[model samples]
Target: MTTSRLEDLDEANLSPAQKVIYDQILSGPRGIVEGPLRVWLKSPKLADKAQALGAFCRYDTNLPPRLSELAIITTGAVWRAGFEWAVHAPIAIKAGVSPQIAEAIRLGQEPQFEAEDEAAVYAFSRELHENRGVSDATYQRCVAALGEEVTVELVGILGYYTFISMTINAFHVPLPAGASDPFPAK
Candidate 1:
């Protein structure tokens, strides 16, 4: 079994600054202080700044949850961020991404998409993650299918989750109890 490099914080032992940040996270849309937030809370100032950006990217972005979650899971797959995939896969599905699509991403394979926008999103995300940037053709496909504004939001979602994935991987964050690693040994 894998163990986290950083120990989880105890709520009762939280410093005042940590408590404040924890409270804000609790009152926010997420209503829970888990995942990378647990790790980020070690540096409260950094947690404050990063969580603010994360809140906007996650809750306030113009990209619909379907597209936003799609970008997130794709980022998770690219990073092999097991914690990220565990958290967001169900959310992606509840927001309309197919189980087949989520599974394909977990396995690093191309999914057969029925919607034009879904196809465009997967392509753009895959290209951005694998190539480090989208080519003109892929960018144009995204903008055409999702419009400039939503496409921009998609980028923000991808970028934010990239940061989250980095945190999860670097900190050796373990999967939640009873949750399997989304990417198992092949």
Candidate 2:
């Protein structure tokens, strides 16, 4: 297990502000504090705002679960964020994303997407991560297939997961106890 840059805080030791954010997270779909939240807890206000945005991105987005999970795994793989990849890969599969596709991304290879929507998401996310922006053709393809609102939400999901991947990578956040690292050293 990798040592985190920031120590994980106990609920009892939390300040009043930290306790508020902590309680909010506990009440949310994510009932446990882990991943980026551990680092974000160092700043209670940022933790509150980030968790709210993350809740929207992860749960409230218009993007379908499969597509959202695909984007997350892609972003996590791009950054070699072991904890993120480990957590999301199974969720991606459960959301109907192909296991082969997730495995391919984990190995840094092009995925053979079984659906047009999956291909569009993979292309758009790959372009955004690689080139820092998507090409007009890619954007148009996504819009045509997923509609404007979902496309926008897809981008938001991508951006949010990117932030998550960066946070996990930067802090060297470890996988949950007994969970294996999905992305092993190359």
Candidate 3:
């Protein structure tokens, strides 16, 4: 069994501030409070701001869901955040990322891509996480394939998911019921 570092807060007993943000999250594009947002709800102020930025990064970004999900899973893979990976990997695939690509990321291996845009996104996310900076060539390639606006949103997606990964990993956020852990013991 997974041991969460934080107690799950009951929605009914929430403080007024927590209730406001909780209600906002419920009514927003997310429609449910789960994963790191639940953990963030412990501090209503943090939850309020973070959830708003998360909503934009997730639902309103210039990058398509396919590429944004790719960056998200890549961050999850790098952080070994099981909750992040388990949640976003399927979304990544459903959004048009190849299963082979997702599998490669799951195993921390380079993926062979069938599309130039996918290759650019994978390279950008992988390099950003692994090297902590993107090389000029990789940045140029990503910008060329995805454009400056999309590339900026890609960076935003990466940064936001990095936050999510840290929350999930640091707080020991449990995966959904019946979901297997995404990463094997390393």
Candidates in order have lDDT scores of 0.92, 0.90, 0.92
Please name the candidate that would achieve the greatest TM-score relative to the true structure. Answer: 3
| Per-model TM against the reference | 0.96, 0.96, 0.97
Question: Candidate 1 residues 13-107, lDDT tens each?
Answer: 99999999999999999998998999999999999999999999999988789988988999999999999999999999999999999999998
lDDT of model number 3: 0.92
- Segments of candidate 2 deviating more than 4 angstroms: none
Residue clash pairs of candidate 3: none
- RMSD values, in order shown: 1.1, 1.0, 1.0
58 Cα displacement, candidate 2 (Å)? 0.4
Query: Model 1: C-alpha RMSD to truth?
Result: 1.1
Error of 3 at 3 (Å): 0.2
lDDT of 3 at 131: 90
Q: How far is candidate 3 from the true structure (C-alpha RMSD, Å)?
A: 1.0
lDDT of candidate 3 over 1-186, digit per residue (tens): 269999999988999999999999999998989999999999999999999999999999888899889889989999999998888999999999889999999999989998899899989998888899999999999999999999998998999999999999889899987889988685
